[model samples]
Target: MSRPMEKTEILHPSLQEVHQSVDTTRPGSLWKKIFAFFGPAYLVSVGYMDPGNWATDLAGGSQYGYTLLWVLLMSNLMAVLLQTLSARLGIVRGRDLAQANREMYPSALNFILYLLAEVAIAACDLAEVLGMAIGLQLLFQIPLLTGVLITALDTLLILFLQRWKIRRLELFIISLISIIGISLFIELWMARPHPIEIASGFIPHLPDEAALYIAVGIIGATVMPHNLYLHSALVQTRKIHRDEAGIRRALKLNFLDSFIALNLAFLVNAALLVLAAAVFFHSGHTEVAEIQDAYHLLEPLLGNHLAPILFGIALIASGQSSTITGTMAGQIVMEGYLQLRINPMLRRFITRMLAIIPAVILISIAGEHAVGQLLILSQVILSMQLSFAIIPLIYFVSDRQTMGKFALSTPIKMLAWLVAIVLIYLNVRMVVEQISGYIIQSDSIIGKISAIAGGAGFMILLLITWLYPIRRKSLVQKGYHLHKPQTPTPVMPIHPYHKIALALDFSEKDHAILAHAFAQGNPNTEYLLIHVVESVSARILGKQSFDQESQQDQQQLAAYVRMFEEKNLKAKGVLAYHRRGKEIARIVNEEQADLLIMGGHGHRGMKDLIYGETVNYVRHHVHIPVLIV
Candidate 1:
């Protein structure tokens, strides 16, 4: 028996570029050190105060007064603790929660987790898109469906912003947070909430079953599952030394960042509840549960003209900020869990479309009231998926093998487990209560039976996950391996002429192709690097001369040739201007090459058809052996 090889390389996504934009050497002032760790938590905090949360807070405040405020406070404290652990996982282990899960779990279990994560992200995005739509409708008198369509354009905005410095994106989100905070401050001031009552609201009391349901909603809305995944990955955006002292400093600064940003979120949530309690509850409108209800009622009850406008502004800001982070989380989860990568723009479009489709159908069929219910239901779905993320996080961070010297201490481990148990219990209770309501309200016998069966299966799944072993050594022993018998090696046949023509596109994949080609090349083999510069709009109009393009290509080709020459390989550079596939075939034949080597994108089906298969075209045209990487 033999052990599998260990994976040593760190994975770097586009967000990793943030590491280059900031100095993390700890050579600055105390404030500067704190500033470097500030961005990720703000991104995480937006999930806490997004429009999904606004519905729960507004509903809780208006219906139950300040009674559910204690839930809001407790959930925020839990968020701070969990987010700190998430950041520690990234800083210490150099992997996000999704990547960590992929590394730890079996293929079947990893796929299950990936599906759950996608569902959770789609649910979160649904709330955000709907919130943005409602905000547009409230502010600009647009239809709900029209606003939903309009919200899709933010994908372009994200694409545009990401082209600039990452720090600028952070500042933009921070500015939106400031707008939300200011808006809430103005609304709270106008409402004149009772200070003593607001203070008493933190005393931990649930009035009835209805309060408990809303309390669960508050927890779901606060400790978002995607935020946990996002934070772990976001912490990796800082360039930190891979040493104990560096990890310690980064962890401490990240804790402060999470604490401050989450507390700000806490204030915003509390202010929303407090404003509702003062204006709606006091005015005998105890059932103002939806956000639109709160927005419409604010102007008449508070006698302030800017109240509704500010509320709508805050909603839009929250939705837009949350949409950005949600899209990033979708990318992180897909790449991390499944090891599948797609263009960020396409990924965003797909996730946004998944959310938008459901929202549009429901809004069209059931109207705006259904949208409000769907928002709350989305948070509930997030709550159900929270345990899948949290349990793995606690198990990994507490394992000495995974965390090394940065592992959680005994006391913190106990506290984290306690938090896990409490959350699990709350989730189960919510699920049971929801199922019981469905079973009782349904008229069809089949529907009742189905609800009961589904609830039982869900609970069983949770039980299995809870009891799953977390010890690393045992898991490694049970892991599957592909074993093959040893066989004798065969000798290779050499060709009389050895000349290789390498087509260069200067893409990242080109490096791999070059490495493969060089590994197979011999000292006697001659290599010619060819690059073609196709004229822009040549297909639409006529071919135009591109002198500067030819010069740049020649420079790039010469640089590559020098690289090969330095490695003691015989090489030459050729620059040409024509259609890429046709010119590459021409170069291979004119150079009298024995083989053609080129890099390819490896796309399939419609993508190959849409992008056009240059490698396929060149292969059909060339007479020699064509190796496509």
Candidate 2:
């Protein structure tokens, strides 16, 4: 005879295969993957031309002209390299940037890095919301505070998009980018910039102190922190294995898509600079703050009022296109770092609300110039926060154990090291510059000393961040355990709806005993009423022709029998049961029944006799807490 299969053996696949097969091919051609890679990168370009970017670009143009356009080339290249690394790490390792960071490093390091990254992204988001509100103010002439509040409504808009195909949604966003792209391209065409000057801008030479600062600001504006987070998480959308081939594919395509999108961004940014340089560079335009300035500057060359309208369309497109990527990135960061899941709408609202607060408050009191300063400073915040993400990506990609053969090569490691060093230097420079500026602005010697002391203290905080994780982990691993106070367990009150099950047969005395037991005992525990119908003897009865009709109707009669059993219980009960065609122990084993209650009849007959074999079978079969009544 053949052996029966065990239950566990029937349910699961081999462990080795589960991770190997992730559903990569759905309902589409190869073009779908190409389009998807295009989606998130382009969505991120919103940050590139945000009202904040507008201010920085405006300042660079008004104060320095096309001198800083060279920065976009380098920054976009950096963005492509880093974003691709992030995406490849996520796709190859099956981990988000934060989770990967947490696993690759000591626990304390993970938590600290996670916290700092969250704060930095949140700060960047605040600036984006502020810029959106400012854009609304420029376009619609709405109150800044009201515009900020209205920006929260974008959450609802994003949530509705979730029901559509992600591809279609991406295409819609791409279309918007194209609209903005073409409009900007047209603006660039109409501007008729001096070809030699634009070429010189690309040749990379800073003319003065003002030019150097604007160049730094452009680099900061072009490469954003959230794009790195967004790209890494987005790469996971494509199905990729941990093998070198999959990593190579993901790395190649992601970098290609990022390069293309960012290059487009670079062209648009350069056009903005060239347009500004041509129209306002030496035209005695000392301070130009409005969309009207770019338009007014262009009217002389375009000989049409259409330029302002096209500029408005482009600005709106820039704001509208980026909203989804920001929302999606917010979702990834929240879920990745905290393991918190929320609908997209609520997450976007939280980010936008935080961002809008400072933008509105400052813009209302201080004007667009202050808003411009906020944008520049926000880039500084972005660059600083980027290290939170970059450190983790570098650490994990460089790890041979996790990545195996796909681990970073020496050349890649060197590149990452360079990126890390540059980030640290930039952060330090920003801090030093801010401190020196504050000292120069102050009147008293005490204030200068305080500014210097604060800057030193801030640097210490940054150092502590990197060291705290290692120290905390070391102390804990050394067995110097820190204990937290335990809270007392709560007393749970008995519930009236509580119940208990008492198995039964057609015995009046058994029903009476159960009624009395319930009346005396607490009602907190729930009863699971059950009936077992034996069907192994069904064919035996029919073949014997003693109870042929009754045997045929056994399944139908089981429900009525249960109802009769419930009727006899007197008190209320919940119904539950198992059936068997052979040994009663089979059902007991399957249900692991808490108790077995069968009648010991007040009758004398061979059929009514108690069976020790049945009781012994149940006792041997189950190991749970059991009762026999």
Q: Listing every candidate in turn, what is its Cα RMSD in Å to the true structure after a full C-alpha superposition? A: 7.8, 16.6
Q: Tell me the tens digit of each residue's lDDT in model 2 across 1-629.
A: 21111112212111111222333445568987555445556666666665556656766776667777777677767767777677666565555565444434555655666665665666666665665665576567877678677877776667567655555666787787788779877877777777887777767777788666666666666666776667666555555443556456666776777777777877777767776776677575747644445655666656767776677677666766666776766766665555556655566777776677777778788875575566666777676666566655676666665566667789989997787677666666766887799788889999999878877865775666455444432211221111223578999974443333345443454566456445534534334444433344433442333244434344433553465456563233322222221234454455444444433434322322233234434556655433444
lDDT of each: 0.83, 0.60
TM-score of 1: 0.78
Which structure among the candidates has the greatest lDDT? 1
Off by over 4 Å in 2: 1-38, 105-112, 241-243, 289-303, 367-369, 443-454, 461-629
lDDT of 1 at 554: 66
Clashing pairs in 2: 126-355, 499-525, 499-526, 499-527, 500-527
Candidate 2 residue-wise lDDT at 606 = 31
Query: How do the residues 470-538 of candidate 1 rate in per-residue lDDT, one tens digit apiece?
Result: 434632222211122347789889664488888988878888778867776788888988887765633
- Candidate number of the best TM-score: 1
Task: Name the 10 consecutive residues with the lowest summed lDDT in model 1.
Answer: 475-484
